[model samples]
Target: MPQTCFELCAGGRSRGLAEIVTGDGNPRHKKVLQQDLECDIVGRNPLHTACVLGHSNIIQEFAKYNVNMNEPTTRGYLPIHYAAAWGQLDALRTLVELGADIHAVNFLDEIARDIAFRYAKHDCVEFLDWAEAKHALQTFISSVQSAVTEQDKGKLHKDEKLRCLSACKAKNDWLSNVKNPTRQDLINQKQLLEDTLLPYLNKLAGHPEIVKSGKL
Candidate 1:
């Protein structure tokens, strides 16, 4: 039997929400979803119900409307927790790809991966492992990119502000004594000294006539 939108939501029908909506950005429909449509049996929302039922298509439809994947139940269990507990591999994978927190803990202080492992869902456990590794790699890449950008900015400032050869020589002498200095360490030292040195360097470079006359 094809349940109506209200009936399906209230009853936790897995295919109800997706089948009802046009997915064309309807405001009324969005409002309906935003409401607390609790399933009488399980007390879960439409998205949570679909997750427990392992309905990937329904989950995708919910995601189209920017559904909250981390929405917790009364028990503080997220959709990811249900997906793992029910051994719904596809549902779990879809949630992970959509940026759900794989490490999120439930009310019982149990993570989704731990629940899947306890339920002996070996495939889900393996998928979670891969997902975690992929996330870590992406974070590392982003940090490296930021560091490169900072280094470039530091080099530009050094070139523009330190115009006098004597000023440059003084900076080099200070850097040579810093133990275990990395590229970032050099940039930090340059930034710390920039404000103090820029004005003096600018004065010396501007008054070339005074410097040539050797009048101190």
Candidate 2:
């Protein structure tokens, strides 16, 4: 019965697709298939403990077994989605090659790409660019605190200077990317970044290098 299946799935060293489907496969994939088993079946849980503990090797083993790569859970995430958010490039690539749906959304209505961007996970961004997913902007917007706000005295100007430098590299950054930036928008997110940092930036405005740095 399904109860037997659930109990078996909940308390085994490893379970296979056949076992899961037949109420007689391995129970936990935490070990057995670790060498090389249908990891898609074993490593199926999204952002699960298995992914966090040894996804790098687990991903490779799954490849050896021809496990369904990038198979989406009910939450619409593949193993790759979790690996990316956690900065596991090797696991991420394995999932991608297996054709994981890069654009899949999570229960929160936010997609993996958005998770990488909002959390400053740059490595994940490189692969997720084409997969950019959007929730209602308002839902997403409400989750962030003031981006550049921090209260350390010596660090505010330094933070602003970096913000300016980061923006300078990307023309759109200076003209518009941070805070809805675009060359035509012309609102000066640099100023906005500094404003958030103002509690600290203002204290350094009178300093020569700080002013010249435009940190204030």
| Candidate number with greatest TM-score | 1
RMSD of every prediction: 15.8, 15.0
What residue runs in model 1 are displaced by over 4 Å at the alpha carbon?
1-16, 22-43, 151-216
Which digits, one per residue and each the tens of the lDDT, describe model 1 over residues 43-85?
5677777777787777776687677888887777888999999
Worst ten-residue run, lDDT, model 1?
207-216
lDDT of 1 at 122: 90
lDDT score, candidate 1, position 137: 34
Q: List residue ranges in candidate 2 displaced over 4 A.
A: 1-50, 130-216
Residue 61, candidate 1: C-alpha displacement in angstroms? 0.2
TM-score of 1: 0.58
lDDT of 2 by residue, 118-189 (tens): 777787776555222211121112221222243443444555656634533454333334463232233343
